[model samples]
Target chain A: MATSAKSTDISKTDFGKSPINARLSAEQKLKLLTDMVRIRCFENESVRQYSAGKMGGFLHVYNGQEAIATGCASLMGDDDHMITAYRNHGHALGVGMNMNECMAELFGKATGCSKGKGGSMHFFAPDKNYWGGHGIVGGQTPLGLGLAYALKYKGVKGAAMCFMGDGAVNQGCLYESLNMASLFNLPVIYIIENNGYSMGTSLERSSAFKSCLAERAAGFNMEWAQCAGTDIYEVRASVQVAMERAHNESRPTMLEIDTYRYYGHSTADAKHNVVGGYREREEIDFYKKNHDPINVFKAKLIAEGVLTEEQFDTLEEGIKAEAAQSAVFADESPYPEVSSITEDVYYEVDRQTEAGRTGKHFFND
Target chain B: MALIEYRDALNQAFDEELARDENVVLMGEEVAQYDGAYKVTKGLWKKWGDKRVMDTPISEAAFIGMGIGASMLGIRPVMELMFWSFATVAWDQIINNAAQVRYMSGGLINCPIVIRGPANGGTNVGATHSHTHENFLANVPGLKVVCPATAYDAKGLMKTAIRDNDPVMFMENTLLYGEKWEVPEEEYLIPLGKADVKREGTDITLIAHGRAALTALRAAEILAAEHNISAEVIDLRSIRPLDEEAILASVRKTHRAVLIEENKPFCGVGAQISSILMEKCFDDLDAPVLRISSIDAPAIYSPELERKQLPRPLDIVAKVLSIC
Candidate 1:
């Protein structure tokens, strides 16, 4: 959707000349671009496979919000944990999950990240400290608090990043976690990707605050900031500072990354019927042409002489090839054996005791 | 062996388990500074400090969900709910998340959390506060429901539930928390899915768990003294992975069977037990399996009405007489 000519311009300063220049190295800049393009490409492939009926369940695409995930995830290390909502393809890709595994998971194959047990909504990589892509709206909010609590209890130098959408913002679980997070000062960051519409409800209709989502954070005595997600630098600047404060001070921050999802909420919702026509294609195209997060980053990289048009073209082609390989790998992967139907219901990896195996399988085992 | 109250047995389990596993943390409202709403936590908070025995706000959904998350990461968390009825607020987390996460993850992760609190009536807490969730939670797969009627069983099974790798719904009755019983001083662990034959008899088998087990025991004594009926009493410690073998064995010995529970009658635990007996021991039974449960209604504030709401020993005695 093209924005009206009178619409306000947000953060037009080139990242190379702004405060981001001092904080970000050239490698980091290239990494951000690569991550964003990789996610965008992967999601595009998902739409293709889904249309072909290669995947069975719902398909939620995170096409336009690439910068929010790529920029924010770059700040954390191995010890950090992440839990996000179900529109999770981009987040999973950003946190360094194998492209093949993530795609295979959607394919319901054994090689998937969650072993095909969790389709679109549930993606877990415990080894990578990416806890899950939970199906419940705001279910991960409290769980992430517990993860952060564990980090603090162990005196580890790590924080937990919990991501949700504007739709999940109003859940009682979020409010409850916020109050508790403030009470104990747990090292956690609650990121709300305010993509304007949650399913079919717009932010203005959903939020009682009726202004900014971050303003609600003040009630919990939590530190919150609002930053545009269109430019990678803007997201990085906000998330880096938030992560630093949470890790060092044992504080919790509620960060609202203002972004937009160009696609409908899921493949189930038709693009033409986006939020019952509240969002026009012109307004959406306006951002894609003028402030598309990925294109904006690509333009910046070219302007800085980091990459020429020819080099960018080669990068795009390479990324497309990589994304295509993931789809093929997912298609070829095997489904888990039938024995796994009842396995993993409890304590699969950790065996607590063998003192008495009597009736163990019937109950605990 | 030393005589101890049901509350002390649970406290000792918390004390020993916390010492046994550093990852075994205790969290709930008033569980730390306030030493638990019912004082089941007691002085363990002082001994273990805030890290292990921590307190939380009156947020059941958040803390219960936290237990699910932490347990998935090797942290054994025994979360206490102020009351079992409060679990309704966090029902989504318990049924949808904790119970299904392991099955859904296909063995990637499992929630080893124990949601324990008082789930009994007759304290005059009225309708909203009381719940006998044995039948309710037992209905869900991927969850182990433990209802220990005695202090000895409470201590042994509390330790077992804490150490087990699966999510367990530990149901404790506040009415029996103060009852005195001889619990062994030595360390012990009672495996789940096993039931105890509290009394051996000949004429009829009485099946019950938690508070109703005590009621059945009393009813057995009354039946023995008043009538010539030698009633056998079976204490089903864990209702989910139920001791069906023991139940069938008992029913075979005693031709008649009677199931008892404090929950309402419609679609309750007895309804399932009766159906099971009909399938397994239909020919062995001399008469149809009868059940005695609380009247089908919500608990009322009035003492007389509450009394009528729950099952009394006389109800069991009459059922045994009727079957005979």
Candidate 2:
């Protein structure tokens, strides 16, 4: 297990000072960078569209947490299942959800992932093994554990990664889930995205132990670790190591990723309201200009002479165009008809068996 | 056919289902190693092993949510809540997540899970464990609530619930667990949304469920012997997707109807029955539809208070006698 001292040192080190650079090929790095940029651009556009009243209902953007979803999902195979809380547009995009389908869903069009019934919070694509973007606070934790239990029962080699915010740590269901998962040694990774706050309440005020989410895992007798969520390499390494332990020992692990969200809890909250506006414009500018995950990867690629600045710009332009096209498709698509409202509530069928063959045919007079 | 107690019948249902489907699992506080709290799951962990028959921590919400997830992945899970009253702790998962998945997901997912537990009064388990909250689950859609009063119904209905593709809330009676009744030796399934006429008569239709149905039957026998008033008794096997047609038909035939429920009169199953009768069989009524229910008081540990709180056979008889 990685020690707290080493993890702390890793967090303090600058992005370029780390020995571990993303080992992806030039093409893969460019593709991943493009994916991350697409998510950011798409969400920014979504925010603009929401303000213009083009989109309706709760619109949760994945502006700041793109690296966590992209990095973790990139490491996962197609068969692995992913379940998370409502802040899920990034995970959906990372798992290969179509930009058009997702955008259309935001527009409440029939072509959305949930066919317009489940807007931003409840996107589901079973074909991709993306279980859901559950709206309930910590409701998905036990469900993710169950999915992993099912996989083990079926003798399959897949793990379930359950994501929740720092606020959801207080939920009793999560604690019980942790105990059960550890007891059964289920192949599950409980990822706590400790983005400093839960909604608007800071963790320091709410949580008794804010800095060490991993120590709590010891109460359940499970392995644990903490890593810098902003650093892609650290996030990837932590996930990879924890996932290995889970898969090999068939045990659950807790990974607390200390990250930050640039936007408010939801699209509705103002960024300047919380923590006495502790986050200065300089800090936001520093992170965006220097430590932005996409930009960091882009500079690495440029330093390696794998891709030029012009090529990277062209890729960004292409993704923006695709996102815009998706928006248009969603705009034109029709809302689900009313008749489908009662469908799929339950799986039931009426069957007929041959009991009596003797029949009398009577002609109507 | 063999005779078995209601509790043994439920055990048999779990045993048979687990043996038939490898994906079927059972979990609760003491369901596995300690045997079930009522011994309904006794000897299950020995036969199915720990993986299939798990004894979970006393976290109702977590285990129930796990059951929901397992069911979504084609594993038919039967979760025991120890007592139905503890369902309040897991209400968020049961009411919000499990019940809403299929509908909210646009039918993409189905919660094929069953929550089994002992419900209703008469056990002296005190106010906490004795209250009958089957009506609470009955109000939720995308869930089938069944309360079987007989061993035959328990076996058949439990089997049906395990095979069902939607979530089912199976309510058992603590007092009736030891009561024996005849059950079929071969495989059988009683489909949901079907009501059974336990006793047929023409004067009045006594609609009841769970333990109240047995009380209604007892009252029918007494009424026949004493006043010669024939009462038709219907056991509403499944509460949701209620057999409104059969109920309306019975009310139309009898003209006078008496609804008996273990729950309070307000917003109980009896209320829905009364509403349907008023709408469909109002003109056919010989008198106003009478309801026999528990008083609007919480169940008490005291025997006298509990007796006053619950619907008694005498209460049914008096209501029937008045209507007839």
TM-score of chain A of 2: 0.87
After superposing candidate 2 on the true structure, give the runs of residues whose Cα lies further than 4 Å from its correct spot.
Answer: A1-23, A271-283, A349-365
Where does model 1 sit among the CAPRI classes? medium
| lDDT score, candidate 2, position B208 | 95
Which tens-of-lDDT digit does each residue in A44-90 have in candidate 1? 99889999999988988898899988887787797788888889888
- Give the alpha carbon lDDT tens digit for every residue of B58-170 in model 1: 89999898778777767889999999989999988898888877766666777778899999888888889987777888877778888999999999999988987788999
- How much is the lDDT of residue B24 in candidate 1? 93
At residue B283, what lDDT does model 2 achieve?
Answer: 92
lDDT of 2 at A128: 78
Chain A TM-score compared with the true chain A, each model in order: 0.92, 0.87
Q: Positional deviation of B129 in candidate 1, in angstroms?
A: 0.8
Q: Output DockQ, candidate 2.
A: 0.42
